[model samples]
Target: MPHDIHIVTEAELRDIVTLDLALVDVIERAFAALSEGGVVMPPVLSMDLPQANGEVDVKTAFIPGVESFAIKVSPGFFDNPKIGLPSLNGLMILFSAKTGLVEAVFLDNGYLTDLRTAAAGAVAARQLAPAQVETAGVIGAGVQARLQIEAAHLVRPFSRVLVHARDAEKARACAADLGQRLGVEAEAVADPAALVAKSQLVVTTTPAREPVLMADWLHPGLHITAMGSDQEGKCEIEPAALSRADVYVCDRGSQCAERGELRAALAAGLWDRGTPPELGDVILGRATGRQSESDVTICDLTGTGVQDTAIAAHVRARFPGAGTVIRA
Candidate 1:
């Protein structure tokens, strides 16, 4: 007898899965499982193509007690948009943990990645941000920028949002869209410093190879989620800014030290090994989150395989036995 396999299309996924608190909780559980040593996640495999301005990353993980595990391939070609295509696309392959059989394939085209990434930001805010958040800011006007703010609103009731982008028009458009979706007073700002100064919670979602947000702009009680620097040589926040953080957290210390904002800090001799606690540790009660209302914090997210696995399992549960079956 042959087994059945499921194939989830991008449209099918978008119709069902949303960037809401439920998804946030799913990703949160993955982090907790990771911190508890209940997951087997290996280092990410990444390839860079500077000539083409593109990169690809492969990540996977096995969580104890989960029925399935997922392997994800994510590709980012910066030049794709110039040819009228999206810069990001990818898919996830789910396998049965019990027998190693193919279970399903989520052809999400990077939507799952975006959703999990944004959820991680919200999880960071829920655990690390100050109790009261009136104003928020985003450092990039991309898709993730808007999603990050939407996810943040689930954890905190921000009344206003400030967005900054290299392109003034894009920034204004993003601000308007966010304002309508979140029902908040979202506006575009020309200065990154002004956005940072006015926001209690800030999210950076750019792909800059250099620091865009400086340390001098950081204020007391501000929590910054830097999700931009997921690759080597890519930095969105200043190394000095990380040094000023009272609590610096990362999704994974090993990944961060090699490819996240912490990497830049370590290279400059500003940070030492084991300096930044993994976000999982905080969630598992092994470490503290916000020690004081005025404490400054930063969460460096480089993306993890555990997130892919968790989301895959969640989606499979939603649409059980709905795809075509294949004979092996």
Candidate 2:
């Protein structure tokens, strides 16, 4: 028998899904399921096109008892902005867990990815950040940078935000925009070290192959979430910083060792691949996180397949019947 496959456009999704505590809760539960040990998530399949300054990653997961799963294809072309195009875009194919049949196609064009990634940052902050955060700092002036600040605010309620980037103009623009939109005191900082010195919460959102954050800048009561280093050869934080952290966590230890900030740390002999606790483990009480308010914490997020599946399932539950549907 043929079944109907719904096609939900990005506009439709934008109208319904948003970055809120509710969405963060959904992603949080997904991470819990991941740590609880029944979800089957595979390693990310990635392809790099150095000539075009681009990369693509395919990720998916199957959590037992979830009605649907999602396979997401995400492409990042760093040079696209030169042509007035966004650097990241992709879609998700939702399938039935029982029959392995296509149920819907989400033409989110990277919105869902941005949402889930930012939500994960919030989870990290909520779990490890100090009791009070007056200022937040973000390294990078891109989409993720802005969203990360917003996400961190949801959990920590910081009153000020600092933006740092290689491009000073873009950094100022991002800061100004965020200040107006978030109704907070936002400014562009020329020095990442200065930003880190003042902020209780910091998020690294760049795709730099070199370190943008150094180890010595870390201070007590600070929590850093490095979400940019999600690919091989990409790094944002100094390797020694991981060793300096009082509590070091990652979305997945193995994945981080392969593609995130931990990869560089592992190569430098500063960390043991199996030593770091995963974010889900801390959330599930399987591991400790931030034993003291003054502890310096770091969270390496390489993005996760279970997050895609969880967000996709959430969308499927609320998908309006207005999208185009075709029988397959």
Candidate 3:
């Protein structure tokens, strides 16, 4: 059997494993693969689409190690609720790392991307979070927030889970659903300040253009995973909050500086551009993650194309070209 070049559809990608396993595993593998070397996953290339309410943008990533990385082309047509459709739409292209071959196409439908990002939350929990956190706080009760609740439970096993969203009802619903799934107590917090003040660990998953997280609200021994601000002008966590942190880590400094949560900090003079280390640097033993029990650590994830390649590898390997092929 020659390498069966299979291309999976969006429906197929949705039928994969559960959120905890797929999302967390993809993220963990992405970082691990990067640390092991031979993967060229640069920060994504994106341009703003001002015609589409300024929210719409086109971004593509090329992973040199995978032979084929994902373009990850997506458009944020968030007004789709009235139109009865999804807000985000896109597909992931998995090309053969060898021979520069465009091997397979996986119709991610944004699910794989979400999972990989959630996996980064899990990794942050493992690496940046302290050993004694009993309460966890989540900002933005969306799909990614739900996944973080699941992943954090697997790592922290918090006694209480707190969530805050722009919509209180949605936050309540997410809290209930996450609590039901994780077998823990979950509550919809009044706001970011309330949530951060109560929990030892915090994960933000909003796409707010301004800061939702407050600097004065955080307590000591807090570990923050800023997941929402992966694009320029999209910031959830406040830059000043980072000043209170003892350590700061990022998925990629170059990528984050242009688009991640750190962009706000860099702009506000809240952080030293040369100080925060990349997660790979920490994983590869080139830098440190946590220093003290009293120290605060923040992991800012901007996401990378290598994650798509890593997850695509797992999916492709499992299927082994199990779809119809079109040679073009």
Return the top candidate by lDDT: 2
Q: How do all models score by TM-score? A: 0.96, 0.96, 0.89
Error of 2 at 269 (Å): 0.8
Global lDDT of each model?
Answer: 0.92, 0.92, 0.76
Model 1 Cα lDDT, one tens digit per residue, 146-261 = 99999999999899999999999999999999999999998999999999999999999998999999999889999999999888889999998887888899999899988999
Instruction: Score candidate 1 by lDDT.
Output: 0.92
Cα error, residue 240 of model 2, in Å, equals: 0.3
lDDT of 3 by residue, 211-230 (tens): 88878776778999988887
Per-model RMSD to reference: 1.5, 1.5, 2.7
For model 2, the run of ten residues with the poorest summed lDDT:
315-324
**Regions of candidate 2 where Cα sits further than 4 Å from its true position:** 50-53, 320-322
Deviation in Å, model 3, residue 314 alpha carbon: 1.5
* Model 2: per-residue Cα lDDT over 126-221, one tens digit each: 999997999999999999999999998998998899999999999999999889988999999999999999999999999899999999999999
Model 1 clash count equals 0
